[model samples]
Target: MGTSAERTGLPDTEGISALPADVPAWRVLLSYVRPHRGALLAGGVLSLATAASGLVLPLVVRELIDNLGSDGPVAELVAAMAALVLINAAIGALGSYVLHRTAESVVLEARHHLIGRLLRLRLSAVERHEPGDLMSRVTADTTLLRVVTTDSLVGGVTSVLALAATVVMMGLMDLTLLGVTLLALAVAVVVIGLVVPRIHRAARHAQESVGVMGAALERMFGAFRTVKASGAEDREGDRLRGAASEAWRASVRAGKWEAVAGNTGGLAVQAAFIAVLSVGGARVASSAIEVGTLVAFLLYVYYLMPPVNQLASAVTQYQVGAAAVARIQEAEALPIEQLGPLPRATDQPIPSPPPRLQPTGTTSAPAAVTFDRVSFRYDPELPVVHDEISFAIPPGGMTAFVGPSGAGKTTVFSLIERFYEPDTGHVLLDGIDVQAWSLTDLRAAIGYVEQDAPVLSGTLRENLVFGAPGATAEEVERALRTTRLSAMINALPDGLDTTVGHRGMKLSGGERQRVAIARALLRRPRLLLLDEATSQLDAVNEAALRDTIAEAARTTTVLVVAHRLSTVTLAHRIILMDAGQVRAIGTHRELVTNSPLYAELAATQFLATAG
Candidate 1:
């Protein structure tokens, strides 16, 4: 099987922790806008109309001023000016509402895409990245896109158009005043351009630092009980504080640059307003322009300030948004599993499929598993875990694997499940390459209980039905009875519906193990792989579950990885492994007499007696 990185054509993330800058930030920013273009366009049109009304208001006021002493109706002129003011106010409010609403939609779409991508990411890729850092990208980073799509994208266009129109209106009144305003604004542009790139770098660092803080906090919570037992609360708190302080430093730096850009625009606009006023007053005194024209041009100069300031703000927002987009793009670039047929993302709500009816009985024909000279290692730098090892298990039998720590025992289970592909050679199921089988179907045929027997946070029923959502009531009862969990469930406050705390913490270790086994059993798989599945069970429960396993072997292939001799003594065959190779294959009695390692392990660890 091809490695996930090779198959997906994504660079192995093991060595590349930094965000790649290969894609242009602008292109990433535009991609987000493409999906919401219709809404953005509508908001932009409204914004433009608002600007148009503002532009016309000055002209209306100018008309009122010029006709003050004329025979024309003064009351009518006042009414026209009043109407323009109300129109401008109403349109501006509506436009703002539209833009803000669209901004929220952009955020929603980004989060949906990002969450979907993260969930489907390859296991290797996920293991390489921190969970909290990925979470920061989903929450904080996606939030930044809202402002970028609205203010930086659509609002930026509106500001530019309005600025252009205001300049034209000023020109019609007086070219001299327009030139003065433009010259003053030019210096601010030069200053702003010099610092804009710095904002992007600063903002990127700030976001990265926040992720670091989140990672630190998550680490503490994951081992909360251990930290308390070890009395390392103060030490861990200091570490979290250090991460937060670093984030604070980076955020302050970003804010400083943004303030500089925004303030520079305000300063430039104010200077331009003063220059326009001084020039227009001189023109009015010289009679080169009428008092009404001078007043109107001054109003136009005042109007120009907002758009100019807005343009500056938009640029600064883009820099911050681009930093976030770069981080988001890096996460999206990680390799993802190509699990069998799934739905493409869409805006429409997906209707849930009707519950699938599962057969009440276990599979009639058990599956045969084979490993063909397979070699594997988790990483290139690590020592090989399996060195050209080969093994086979026929259908419908109980087999046990016994090995010392680091002897590649659990790796066998992983290989069978294709969690990590073999570095060389093949793993086959019933003579067909496992890689060739559909992942969904291949997994459906195998029931795996991991070494930890992890249980998710949910109700007792949810955990039991996780692997088989459609298991019939009778099947559920049978599994519970087989696992000796009937008494525990009957005693619960809500029976099967009782809530199990996080990681099933509310249940005892042994009960959690039973829940995990029962969950797998509900699937009625042909090949059942149990890795230390009964390690936590007491003697009575262990013997009962062992009998259940012996019975299950009659109908399915049962493979167990165990250290206890009692667990494997009755197996039809046992494979003893040492260092990455199979040392001996025989019944427990045959191995006890023939293999020195097996005899030593049985006598020392398993407390076996040679009767």
Candidate 2:
């Protein structure tokens, strides 16, 4: 799969382009600021006040020097100086508070919004995108946003305000000196113009590198056990190191550009000060400018250095922030799955299907699921996984799909769950098109357990109640018993409170499968789909699972993709599949007597075990 940078064709610094062009990146960034507008306003005002106070100090110093003897009280001059220091300190504190608060809020909101979008996104979109890249957005990219929000914005604002105030103070002292300062500042602006975009591009690349590194790490860790077992740990380590090195190189490039911007600004400001002092000194000596005014003007001119430096810093920060914005926008731009409104019960409810055929009578009659000439292909250019596949499971019964690997058995469950829409034909539920029903409603009506039996990192009780949050403790215990996991639960030191490690790696395979079954059972789904849940289990474990499935089928219509011959034998009817097509349909005994492929498979399994 192509990396996000390669796919989007964005420069490394530009990050992902998750947002539409119609939506301005600045607008999205500013949205985070909206909630704390009042705080920001106060911070800005404080910064301005500090700048104004800084301007007043030069004037005070000029007066104090000019009226040294008998023109003013020394105590008054001392008091004014002390007041300026106190005011500046208070303003600085206020500004810091505002900036810090804003940064926290931005990070918090961005994380929450991104996570929510990720959860709501379609499974297909997630499958296509790398999890490492997504993780980068949440972790590394968001951290950059924090810097942009607090330090960048605050520094940029203070710099501009201080520069403007300094310029005005210099003008009051001597307009000629002010003109010289402004001219020097203009040169610095040109230098900034040349450098800002480079910084932007560099910063973007640095962020992209982080994402790439993250993706690489995720791939390595996702299959850590397999990689270790295959003796490929050294190779995986080298790959991750390469990704980290790339990120480091990109960051260095960005830092180099930032250094150029800072140094260039500093040099320009110093040159401006030299020109102003030389020219002003000559004017004072010639009596063209007052000595007091010359001294005050020089002070103001010196003050311009900070603003000039700040302007450069702000420009660099803006570029970095823009890059961060692009990354965040890309995350927001993923295609999210749209869930419809919740279904409401009507006074005139739809009539129930026949009692003998009814799958479950929990809330209402179970919806009948039918795949009418369904065709599906994961890749558009590749051969279909399911080709013109047609099947119907009545309201209630056990229907098993039996086939070898690559027969597209699991694809059937994916289709029924609407995880992937069919390329052709329609999937109907209770006579209505599957798409017509809300995603939530469709999924709520069906329970699916995968072959690997994925379990989340949480307590045993948390995992049990995950599918149906409202499931009572008694209900949880009952479901555990139904899945034959009660013994495992009893054996655990923490029982229901035991924490399952990442992907439930802490538990045995059989324990994880049972936990998954218990979770699905808690949902009380009308249609239960098991995708070879017993494929990886031992005979004893498989028998226990079979009993659990049998119990579940009595209340819910169970459709299983069978891997073992024993599992197929328990099915009321078997749909024999081959190369994405249903080749035969009959009981195991009937298929053995009639279907040539079925008989061949049974004979092969029996012979292979005997040998």
Candidate 3:
């Protein structure tokens, strides 16, 4: 019952979630940790206990020094020390196993969340992002959560606790020496704090640059055909090289920051060592501290450095991980359209609605789509594609839209398909306002084919039945025969099983279009919208397409965007569009006599020449 935001990666918040990016590093890390509370607690306790084992070495040393020559108890002491070491080693390993297991789970959950979010994103939102960049963020950025949660996050806490215990032990052994060491180490702590943020910033920049490189390469390769045709291989390669170089530079910058952070801890530890030696030497000479106690105190002092250093290193790692979190969080913040208005992650997800069935009663009749004073545009600043224009295509016959390019012929189809909402006026489908019909039901009744009629890289049968997953084999054959794909299928080595290649490049333009038509026909839709369905067809194929349209029209409505007017000259009716308005509507002769625009379109460049 997870809401769309939960099912997807979106957080339960309004607007682009700048919060995960802007929140304190600890808070953000804690959010990921919260899901594995029991494991974190158990792992933390084990890690702390293991860290305590280091203190035992100092005690064992002190005991050996104190018991020397008194009892030749070396064997017993050695055995005891060895036992402690084994236990510590075993505990630390188990803690590591638990933490890393939790880390892997976090990474998996994050990837699933991001993939869901990407899929649920509105069509327009997805168009804004490069597929490669989004892909990198999902695959690469989410992995960072693993290290952040385990090594840097839990490990850092354990290091701090161990460091605290060591400092206390050192202070008990000798207060003055401990104070001197802390003073010197204070400088290192300050340095680490200053440089750690730089590491984070550098890591962010590096990741961003990598994403940019991926996006650039994806864009170039997506249109590789055009690039190869234009012979821009060298230029495109240089462009990709520049992007890669930028990524390299950014990574180098992050490396520089990491080096500085690591060195700060080393320098602090070195200076503290020197200060403690000087102070402790004076105290031993004055007989203020015993030799064994001094040795034990120094041992604790040395023990303090690793955890101190680990804490610093963890902070630096946090910066690196934080940068990745920012990218992931940003994607989660994008507006999700399918969550309904004011979409937010919630406890209950909106389930897919049940299919809508056409009403069947003596009083109810099939719907004829109507546009009443519709006005629409893709961009608000741009001119309207459909300008307060209206038309009606009654059901039960083939209807053809004929017009020049950009005359809003396609816009009409777009509105009917609900790809874009009209700025004003109503688009009615079947006696009811289109806005009232649920999206699922509205789309369920119609079959649409674009001008290019794209086919995915798969078996021809897959492309054929894509719209109608439940269509039987006989239904598929019937569609192939009607759209003239049966002949091409016979030539293919595997017939309907042949690979179509990317965008169906393996098939000819005409065959691809026929495959698309066949796919639409298999859907058995109440309304079929085909844009330029026969534009790529030869005379024989075009005649076959026209006959198929006429036959399909007997049972359901067929709407086609006619490119060659002569092909649809015998259609039941024609809606002639000019400059986003319905200039005239009639049959071939009626339009030729009544509308000059229609006559010119039928007798001129596109139609007459093609015919």
Cα miss at 608, model 1 (Å)? Answer: 9.6
lDDT of 2 by residue, 139-244 (tens): 8888777777664676677777788767766776678877887788788788878988899999999999999999998898777778989999999999999999
Please write out the lDDT profile of model 1 over residues 284-329, one tens digit for every residue.
8899998888788878878887898889989999999989988898
TM-score of each candidate structure, all chains considered together: 0.90, 0.90, 0.86
Better of 2 and 3 by TM-score: 2
Among all windows of 10 consecutive residues in model 3, the one with the lowest summed lDDT is 357-366
Q: Comparing candidate 1 with candidate 2, which one achieves the higher lDDT?
A: 1
Better of 2 and 3 by lDDT: 3
Where model 3 places Cα greater than 4 Å from the true spot, the runs are 1-33, 339-367, 490-497
* lDDT at residue 159 of model 3 (Cα atoms): 89
Worst 10 residues of 2 by lDDT: 349-358
Give candidate 1 misplaced runs (Cα > 4 Å). Answer: 1-21, 69-72, 340-360, 608-611
Error of 1 at 240 (Å): 1.5
Worst 10-residue lDDT window for candidate 1 reads 345-354
Model 1, position 233, has a per-residue lDDT of: 97
Candidate 1, overall lDDT? Answer: 0.84
